[model samples]
Target: MHRLLFALDPEEAHELTLRVLSLWSERGPLLEVPARLLRVEDPRLQVEALGLRFPNPLGLAAGMDKDARALGAWWALGFGFAEVGTLTPRPQEGNPRPRLFRLVEDRALINRMGFNNRGAEEVARRLWRFRERGLAFPVGVNLGKNRDTPLERAAEDYLRALQALEPYGDYFVLNVSSPNTPGLRTLQEGPFLDELLSQLRPATPKPLLLKVAPDLSWEALDQVVELCRKHGLEGLVAVNTTLERPGLQSPWAREAGGLSGRPLKGKALEVLRHLSRVEGLTLVSVGGVEGPEDVWERLKLGARLVQVYTGLVYGGPLFPRRVLKGLLKLMEAEGVRRLEEVWPPIP
Candidate 1:
């Protein structure tokens, strides 16, 4: 069944999956069908982070359900939580076609799909409806500046989207690291990030975090972490995607935009390990998390939570349940009592 999706264009396959999930989300009870089959409801998997309680530490990374179209479906598939959007203040068609590529041999995807969505207002309404179902699932919203918005006013775009979706999300992420938008990654730099955070931090009492790129140098990452603390943000989503192709085997590896999946594991873990040294910053790790061991590695290294995108695309619907179950077995072998006790208390 998953192979059938591989036959279609990457974006087309993604759209079809979302459409099916959206229909499933409409009938709230039907979600229970998949939930019973896929969800692993164990107290040991529960985690506390970003001022919210997650059923498990695993999550669906942002950019999967860009417009909040599949909340129930994600829950049914057994994710602990889900982050939706890379939404802008306005609706956008994004860049031209062939923007998403599958690096089959590399077990990866390269997408330059620039902030495509039906805008913040529409997404917020969808989220409101999702909330009305009262599923107890935590939903995060990732905010991005529109493609046409200049770098100077980038903070305004973020603030506008956050304002629109504030009440609807359990947490909000400032997405300044996507390579698809011209100069978007610049927002991760010292001056730009400091300015952006200053404008955004005070706007809401919700857990506000920043998403960063994997291409940053250690010095640059330090600057990002400093600003995040200075502005009183909650935590960070440790990576967006990589611009570097590394040692890819697929012909499309050279495509522009960001590269995700197996190749990103090394750098993503490197970034998470570096950030883990920081005392108060909560870390949500992503990139190349293909199995239970990857999730366990992040949690052990002080990442309070972890998310997956490319892994899910390749692993099919049962991936979350299988990984979570495997995580339990791994934890039992290591003598872990609970996810909260995975690491010593951060000072």
Candidate 2:
């Protein structure tokens, strides 16, 4: 199944995969057998962050289920939480086709998919439908501005999305970090960030998080961290797909877009470690996490939660379950029962 899916166009293959998950969602209880076998039910895996409880620390990252199509399936797949979207106030066609690429040798993906979705209203409706049936775990909405929206008016786009989806989301992510959108990363600068956050923060009912680019320097990152703190932001998702392409063995490596997967792990971890030093912020570690060991390392490094997207593409449906089991083993071996005890004391 994995091999066949990989052979098709990346976006098309992704759609087909979603369809499969949607089937599982419709059937509902059909997933119970798999869930029972795969779920790791340790009290230690339960995580309380952003005023909500996650059955485990691992979650599906944004961009995977952009439209909230299979919320139930993600829960059944054993993910503790799922972030849907990069959804905009208005629906976008996104960048031209062939925007998503796979570097199989590197176990990575590079995508310039510019927040393509059915728009905020559609996503909110989908969330409502999912919620009517009841959500099994926490869900976050990753908000983005439309491509044509000017930088000066960007906050309006985010505010609009926040208003539309707030009722259904457990948390909200203000995504100013995606490299594919024109001038989107500029929002990370202090003045723009402050302006954006100031407008939305007061009105936001849920825990608001800032998703930042990994390419930022320590100085730039410091500014962002401080800004998030000043604005009363609750959490940060360290390291979106990077613009910088390090050593690469794939022919498609030169293609333009953000690079995610193993290459991002080191930088993502570095950023996570930096953010963990600050008090009053929950850090969500993403990028290059592939297995139980990676999840364990992120926990020890001070990530309150870990998210996986590219890893899911490479690791398959059973991946999250395997990681949870691996986490259980690591926890037992270390003689720690709770995720809070896993982190090393900040120096």
Candidate 3:
């Protein structure tokens, strides 16, 4: 069944996925689904990050549910948190058809999605409805500027999305790293980043997290840490998908988009280690995290929490819970009590 899903063209596969997801939403999450293959009972796995308590440290990363439409089903799947959207101030069709490609040979994906979303207002409206009924866990909103929006006015777009969706989300992710959007990653520059965050950060009380690209230099990472500290932001989602293709085996490796999955493991871990050195910054490690070993490795390096998107897509519905279970086994073996203890002490 899953193989058939992957066999189709990326766009067709995505549409089929959406249709299947819509059906699941209508039926709602199966609470009694049981942790048959996935683990859900680990006392030592509870964690608190980004001003919110998570039942466990593993979360569903952004881009999985771009419209906030499947909060109930995902939460039921046992994720500690679910970050939704790269939603813009207005709706966009995104780049074009075939923007998403799977590199099965390398267990990766390349997507130039261009932040396509139902616009922030609609996203907020649906989120409000979800909350009104009740969401099973914390849901963070990922904000981005529209593609045609000029870089100078990007903050305006982010602020608009933030202000409009503020009441709906438990947290916010400033997605200045998605390579699909033109000039988006440039916002990582110290001056441009400061300009944007200065305008948008103070307006929201929710824990604001900056999502950065994995390909940043040490100097750039240092500057971003300084900027976040200056703005009084809560944390950073260290290392979004990378554009580099060093050891890729997939034919789609040359695709014109950010590459994510196992291929990104080494560089993403390095970035996590570097960012971990920054005092007083909580880091949510993302990119190339495939299993419990990957999660444990990130925590050892310096991640307060971890998020997975590509891994889930490749590993199927039980990925997050399976990873969490494996994390519990690792913790038990290592005599660790809490996920926080897995973090390396600041030197």
Candidate 4:
């Protein structure tokens, strides 16, 4: 069923994928997988990050569901948590079509989708309705500025999205990392970032996570860490996606967009390890994480939690659960008990 998706164009594949997820939601949670099979060996998999308890560290990354429309289905499939949206303040057609290219050889993808979604207002409505009834798992909203929004007005874009979805999300992710948006990365610079966060705090009451790119330099990362600490932000997702194409073996690697998958593993870990050195910030590791070993490595590098996206595209629905199960076994083999013990030590 997965390979068949490879044959379709990226947009078609995405639509079909959402349809399948919608169908899954109708059937409800499949609890037959058994809690024991889902347990990691450490037995202490639960941790409070961003004021929320994650059953385990592995979660589904944002962009898979831009609108928070499939939270229930994702939880049923066994992800510990799910992030939705790179949602904007207004609906966007999101760049030209053919923006998403798959690099099957390297199990990677390059997407310049431009933060496409139904905007914060509609998404918030759906999310509020979902929460008013029930939720399958915790959901975080990954907020972004619109493609037409100018650089100076960027804070307003983020502020609008944040205020709209603040009530519905388990957490809020400030996405200043996507390469598709022009000038968005510049927002990561010290002064610009400080202004953005300063303006955001006035309206947002939720735990905030700043999603950064793997392409940052050592100095840039240091600035980010300081800014996050200064603002009392809840955590940092170690990466968004990369613009680099090194180590890729796929035909699609040449496509222009942010690259994500197995090729990104090493750099992502390096960033996580770097962030781990910080005293108070929580790090949510992402990028190139494919299985249990990667999850274990991220935890050891100071990531309180980790998220998977490309792995699911290449490994399918069973992947998250499989990673969690394998992670437990690895933890047992290493004689680690509490999950927090795996956090990266101060350098």
Candidate 5:
């Protein structure tokens, strides 16, 4: 069954899966019927962060269900939260097809699937309906500029998208680090980031975070931390996919895009370890969180929450439950009485 999906073109498989889940999302209480079997509703897994409560630390990262199509399905799959979109103010075609690649040998993926989302307003409408369901799942909106937006005016794109999405999301993420968008990564620089954060911080009272790149220099990373603080932003989603393809075995390694999954574990952890040390920011670790131990490590390293993308593509729908169960075992071994007690963002 899984082999059929793996055999299909990555994007095709993704769309096919989303279509099925989108239908399932419309099922209302039926979604919870599966939740009874799939969701591991332990009080120990509850997490409080960004002034909102999450059922667990595990989240479906942005770029997966870009249109908020499978939200109810995600909750049924047992993800504590989900972040959708790298949405722009306007819809886009994104980079041409065959833009997403799978690296099975490396348990990884490479995607330059630009910010190809159905614009903010359309997605907001979908979210509004999802909100009416009143599920406890926390959804995050990750905002980005359109492919054609000038780097100088990128803040305008984010601001407009935020205005459309603000009332819906539990939190909002500024996704300036996606490599597929030309000049997008430059938004991480000192002045540009400072300006971007300055403009966006005042836009919403919702929890706002900056998602950073895995390939950044330590100094550049620190510059981002300082600017986030300077702007009074909430926290960060550490280490988005990396452009550097270090020691990859797949032929897809040559593809021009950000590489994620196990290949990104070290760099993601490295960045998380660094950013987690900062005084106040809540770090949401992404990049390559595959299994239960991966989430535990991120929590220990200072990530108040963690997100997964490539891992899900390879691990299948039951991945969330498996990891959540494994996490419980680890917690029991560590004698952790509660998830919150174990994750004070260890130095």
Candidate 6:
């Protein structure tokens, strides 16, 4: 299944995969076999963050279900939470075709998909339907600005999306980190960040998290951490996709856009380690995480929650269950009963 999907254009494969998952979500019988094979339940894996309880610490990261199409299928696939969208105030066609590439050898993906989605109003409707049907796990909405929105007025776009979707999401992610949108990463800096957060903070009833880029300097990261604290934000989704392509073996290495998967693991971990030192901020780690050891390491390193995107492309549907089960074994070996207890171990 994975190889066949890989044979098609990356974006087409993605859409086709979503359609299958959406069908499974809409019909119970279709999910039975996969759910039994994939779902791993353990009280010890429960994690409480941002005022919501995750059945497990693992999540399906943003970009996978950008329009909230498969919210119902995620838990069946073993993810404890699912974040949807990079949804803008309005619909967008995103970047031109062939914008998504797979670096097979590197076990990574590079995409310049510029926040393609069905718009906030449309996605909010889907979210409401999911809610009406009863979501099985926590869901977050990742907010992004429209492609044509002026960088100066970017806050207005995010504010619009936030207002429309806030009632439906368990939490909200302000996505200023994606490299595909022109001038979007710039919003991570001083006044622009402050202005955007200031405008959205009061209106956001749910916990607000800022997703940041992996390419930030230590100094810039410090500023972001401080600003997050100062602004009363709930948490940080450490390290979005990276623009750097260091020591990659695939021919697709030179392709433009943010690089995710194994190539991003090292830097994403470094950024998470740095953020762990900050006293009050919650950290959700993403990037390069593929299996149980990676999830365990991130939790020990101080990530309250961990998310995956590219890992799913390579690891198949049962990946989350495998990771969760692996975590249980690790916990048993260490004689710890809870994920939180495994972290900051006694010396």
Off by over 4 Å in 2: 343-347
- The collision pairs in model 1 are none
Following a full C-alpha superposition, what root-mean-square deviation does model 5 have from the true structure?
1.3
lDDT of each: 0.92, 0.90, 0.84, 0.83, 0.91, 0.90
Q: Residues 1-347, candidate 3: write the lDDT tens digits.
A: 66788788876876777667655655533433543334485668787777788888888889878998777667666788889998999999999877889998998889888888999999999898788866447888999999999999999999999999999899999999998898899999988999998998888888998999988888988899999999988889977888899788887788898898888888888888788778777889888889999999988887888899889888887777778778888989989888777665432
- Comparing 2 and 5 on TM-score, the stronger one: 5
> Model 5 Cα displacement at 169 (Å)?
0.9
The model with the greater lDDT, 2 or 5, is 5
Q: Model 2 clash pairs?
A: none
Report the Cα lDDT for residue 255, model 3: 82
Write model 2 residue lDDT over 1-347, tens digit each, in one string.
98899889999999999999988876757876676777767788998888889999999999999999888888887999999999999999999989999998888899999888999999999899888986568999999999999999999999999999999999999999999999999999999999999998997768999999999999999999999888899989987999988897888899899999998899998888888788888889999999999999988888889999999999898998899999999989999878877765332
Deviation of model 6 at 136, angstroms: 3.1
Candidate 5, which ten residues in sequence have the lowest lDDT sum?
Answer: 338-347
lDDT of 3: 0.84
Off by over 4 Å in 5: 345-347
Q: How do the residues 141-180 of candidate 1 rate in per-residue lDDT, one tens digit apiece?
A: 9999998889999989999999999999999999999999
lDDT of 6: 0.90
Error of 2 at 158 (Å): 0.4
Poorly placed runs, candidate 4 (over 4 Å) = 29-43, 344-347
- Model 2 worst lDDT window (10 residues): 338-347
Each model's TM-score?
A: 0.99, 0.97, 0.94, 0.93, 0.98, 0.97
| Candidate 1 accuracy as lDDT | 0.92
